[model samples]
Target: MPHINLLPWRELQRKQSQNKFVTILLLVVLVSFLSMYMLSTYYGNLRDGQNIKNSFLTTEIGHLDARIHEIRELDKKKESLQQRMRLIEDLQSSRNLGTQIMDEVAKIVPGGVYLTKLERRGSAIHVIGRSESNNRLSTMLRQVQNSYLLEKPTMQGIIAGEKSSRLLSDFNMEFYVKPFDKIGEAKQ
Candidate 1:
């Protein structure tokens, strides 16, 4: 028989099989690492996009807040102007009322009676005056009742003055002034 060594060849074949296994394992590990890296990059890009959207929304909210503040200021100014206009209208109406009231008061006063002091509280008029006698006072009350400027005249109080040489008698009266439509007409 011829002398032949097969042991070395068998050892070489085994070594080649081990090398193939190691190469396949290394390839699997590299593929898994690449997949993980790609997934992480995709998630990072998604987070960056969300952050950009949030910033844009924040800027829009800020602009809306400013507009709301400006609208509130304008509303305040409008209210102030409306109040001022109302006050001016009231003043103008009162100016015309004063003239009408004075004319009515002049027409109601008797020739002999003289008014010393006149005061007004709301719609009420308080008059302190001197008259010749009680008859004159009665006539004055009647004149006030018949006057177009006075309404619901109720005698509040009356007192006889002490004997004096002065031609004037002492008396005081309070009544309400009738509001006329003409006074309110000026507002229109």
Candidate 2:
């Protein structure tokens, strides 16, 4: 209404607004940098914690690996010891087999049958003997067949030898010896 000059007032108001905007921008820039630094610190702490856990897991894995190797060694030793024990057991079981077989043969021989040779080859016994007559030789074979320790009695040969006081027949036989446990079962 009045012819008033308002240019200086508008210029001053514009300068004040510009000052306020600069102040607000400076505060915003400082707050942004501070938030970024805080976020970076938090992430770095999280990364350090994860690395520590990973290192602990790796150490535990190494210990477990060592224990596994020890267990494998123990298993091998156990297997070796078991094999030795089995061999000893086998030797122990067969220790008196020869004596037992000889005793049984001596007991089962009938009268007047003279044994010339008694040898064992594997599981079989080879016998060479002289008898007064064929009947006595057959009796010996029957005794051998009925005995508990012998099986599959087989006569290989019989030759009429020269008279030695009486008629003598040379004979050879072969038979398999039964296992001790099997003989015991037969006795029962």
RMSD of each: 7.3, 6.1
Query: lDDT tens digits, residues 6-120, model 1?
Result: 8899899989998988999999999999999999999999999999999999999999999999999999999999999988886776666667777777878778888889888
lDDT of 2 by residue, 60-103 (tens): 99999999999999999999999998778767867877887888
Q: lDDT scores for all predictions? A: 0.79, 0.88
Best by lDDT: 2
Highest TM-score: which candidate?
A: 2
Our model 2 lands, by Cα RMSD against the true structure, at 6.1
- Model 2 — TM-score against the truth? 0.53
In candidate 1, how many Å is residue 164 off? 12
Report clashes for each candidate as comma-separated counts.
0, 0
User: What does candidate 1 score on TM?
Assistant: 0.52
C-alpha-based local distance difference test score of model 1:
0.79
